[model samples]
Target: MITHIFNSSIVSGPEMLVIPALKKLGEAVSIIFLTETRLPTESARPIEYAMKFGYDVYSVPVNGRWDKTAFLELRNVLDKISPRIIHAHDVKASLYLQQAKRVRPGFKGAIVSTHHGASYRKGKIRLYEEIYVRFVLPSFDKVLCVCELDRKSVIHRGVPEGKVSIHLNGTDRPRVLPEDRNASAATIRKSWKEKMPELPDTDAAVFLGAVARLSPEKRHDRMLKVVASFKKREESGHCKKTVLLCFGEGPEEQKLRQLARTLQLEDRVFFMGYSNTISDEMAGFDALLCLSDGEGIPINLLEAGWAATPVISTRVGGIPDLINSNEAGFLVEKKASDESIAEQMWNMLQNTKQLTSVGQAYQKRVMEFFSHDAWLKKLNEVYATLPGKI
Candidate 1:
């Protein structure tokens, strides 16, 4: 049995990658997902999806405090299950498991951790992450990183090179019928048009968009500045008609909206809040614009490519591994200036034929490298090598 522990049941990139891989592992494999946050809808999509594929599901009431009682409860459950392997999905969960093992040390299973992103990049969180790596990381039998870039980052911060492994995140290529895609596109376009009627119906009305939680690291402010600069160029007759669509919501939504208004981009930009069907929405866009400060291979980029939409992204995190400038997609430098983003946008807009060709190449690359089956095969290999596994 393989048991996975996480901090929340809310939908995110890592959950999407892990759940689908677990489902493909077949019914003989016992899987358990433990999360502290309860699903608001009661219809937890991850749990429901896992159950549909015949995996045992469990939800324990875990308080916010990661105290001795929490550790004891987790250890007690581990004792009952006697799982062959325990895999913690994030830093907090990994630390909790490490603490639980210290109190109850007889657990014979191998402990593994998959570090999803760079926690150190977020101000004082770096200090906490340094401490965790120094103290808690060595306790795990193995540490896994979601991408090669992350593996290097962890190793640089004190994880032994030999103890770390790289496993790229994966996605299932959803069966997108032509009619379905067209319908989805129409729905998305209609909603955006309703919100911003000034948008033209001409092909010149290029949709440049992104889908990510509105956070400081996502650099939505930087993206908005880029759009503002583009709008300036358009007004000056140096660029053509374009629109920017931002999907997903977080604490920074209001701040980003304010920034848009300050830049006089109120008419040219639209914030579509959080939408569950982001993949369907990507179809309406001419290209995806991702300007994150960091990431571990965003699944949305892969999804967009799978849908044959080209990407314009910052050269950060594991993105470089998935995209090649002007080949698979365009790569802008990190924290790029407004002028740089504007130039790239203009270049892409001017070369429609080139953009389409690159997007097609990107679609083929995703099929070859990021498929659900590829993820399952790699994970099964890791599972087979774990200590105490059957």
Candidate 2:
């Protein structure tokens, strides 16, 4: 069995790949929940979902980041399942998989990990990642990267180029959108005004949505500036009002709100905080925005493409794969300044027919090329070529 290791808390992009993998791979896969707490409470979403698939789900708790003893405990669990592959989704699990080999010398399973993407995490998290990139990652027989940029990043750090493989992220298309597009959008707009009383009338407003954690890497402030620029155009009677609804919460919430206030976009920008209905609500907006400084084949963009929601995103990471070549949607050209990208967002709203055509092309690309079956086939191929043989 291929035992997948997920050490995640919230259900985000990783689930976009993992949940379907569990369902598709079925009995061929099991799961090892490596948790920092006693009950693996941090990973409740994945654990509960994996159990529904009837796979063997093992929850092993490491006392803390410094716990080498955790690997000894893992050996007890490994002895029972004896999975030939231990595939980790994060740096911490990948590091411990390396340590598990040191503690249990007889173990011969192949070690594999998925490098999601690079991000600007600081403090102890950053330190651990530095070690993980430089040391622990080299020990893995295979390192699956979500994008070419990530493959280049790891190989440049010392991992053999042969060991790294690029697997662009994919998604299952959301079941067909509600039949009445106008009614669905009206419903979404009505629901938003009811929940967020502070929001201005959105019926005629060009609604733009951003779905991401309010983290520094997401660069929400850039989105706020776009709205501020739109407000300036509106004041000069040059454009319609644009409202930005930011979903997901993080440590940077207050900071972003302060910047919004500073830019005088209080009425134009609305913080939706955290919402589970991001996929459903996103269909109402004119377009979705992804302003991250770094990314992989981000699941949100994939969902946007499938939902037929045109996206205006920074040209970073694997986004060009989705937008360019096909001319599927808007792209803020490389190394463009904050002012330039703000203009990109501005230009996206200038034409309505272009939005529908671009969104349809993006939808076509996602449906034809980025399917669950295609992703799993690549994953299975990666598993087949691992250096360790059972």
Candidate 3:
């Protein structure tokens, strides 16, 4: 059996992939959560989900850094489960597992890790990646990358190429059925407008949506700037009314809201926090926006393709691999100005006829390259090759 280890306290892209994987793996796998340092709400939902699926679940304190007690607790759990394979979801989990391996030498399971993102780095974060990849990653039997860029990044960081492999992240079909998307969208738009009456009401409104944590890497401030520019265009009567509705919760939430207010986009921009049914709401949008400075194939973007909603994203990380720039969807530069994004949004609104073909192209690519079944089969094959697997 294989045991999956990941952080269960924060709701992020990696957590989204990890939860569904645990559910699908079912009885063949178990999960160990690296307990959050802060209050766990959305992140803890995965643990509840594992329980619903009747899968064994455990937790060990992990404070995002080295914790000797967490290592001991993890070792004890490994001793009890005695899994044939140990799959760590991110760097921290891998670090903890490496320490546990040293402490519990008797448990000889193959160690594996998934590099989830190509995040911006500086100071301690850069130091951590350098140390981890140079020292810790080599010890793993396999280091799975979510994209080709991440695989190269791992190798460039001093890991042996033989130990590294790419297992492109897979996306699930839209959780919301086609019949339900429209109704879900209408209901959300109505309810949100009712809650905040300052937002303009117009039958010609173009809805642009994004679901991402309000973090620096997410570039939410950049999204707000785009919204500001779009609103400027709207004022000039260049197009119909435009609004940017964001869904997700994170540390940068207040700062982003403040930026929105400063940009005088409070009326046109809305931060709806986390939504369990964001997929259902996609049908209401004209296009999904991903303005992150870097990413590892965002789940929201994939969900957009499945929902047949076109995308407008910055060309970063694995994004270009999916979007073909004006064919499948729009691809802005990594440091694209708000005016550029706003101009694209306006053009997309004006050229609604092209959306259908672009969405189809993206959906086709998703089916061909990013299917969940194929990803699971690859993972199982890797697990079977491990030393203790029967």
In order, the Cα lDDT scores of the candidates are 0.74, 0.78, 0.77
Clashing pairs in 3: none
Candidate 1 vs candidate 3: the TM-score winner is 3
Each model's Cα RMSD? 3.1, 2.5, 2.6
Candidate 2 deviant stretches above 4 angstroms: 38-45, 52-54, 119-127, 175-180, 200-202
Candidate 1 residues lying further than 4 Å off, grouped into runs, are 27-54, 175-188, 191-204, 238-240, 387-390
Q: What is the lDDT of candidate 1?
A: 0.74
Question: Which of candidates 1 and 2 is the stronger one according to TM-score?
Answer: 2
Every model's TM-score: 0.89, 0.91, 0.91
Report the C-alpha lDDT of model 1 over 1-390, residue by residue, as the tens digit: 778876555567887777757766753444444555444443265566567766666555555546667788778777777777888877677888888777755776888888887532676666666766777787788887777788887888788988888877778656444346556556678776776676655355778888888888898888788777777777888556677888887889999999989988887778887676776567677789888878778889888877777888888888887885568988988866768877877787679788777777787777788877777777777767775542
What order do candidates take by TM-score, descending?
A: 2, 3, 1
- The residue-by-residue lDDT of candidate 3 on 237-353, one tens digit each, is 767777888888889988988888899887678888788777555766778888887887888887787777789888888887677557788888876567877787667767767
Candidate 2 yields a Cα-based lDDT of 0.78
In model 3, the Cα lDDT at residue 195 comes to 62
> 96-207 in candidate 2: lDDT tens per residue?
7777778856886888888887544567877887788889888888898887777888889898999999887877756435355556677778898899987766576888
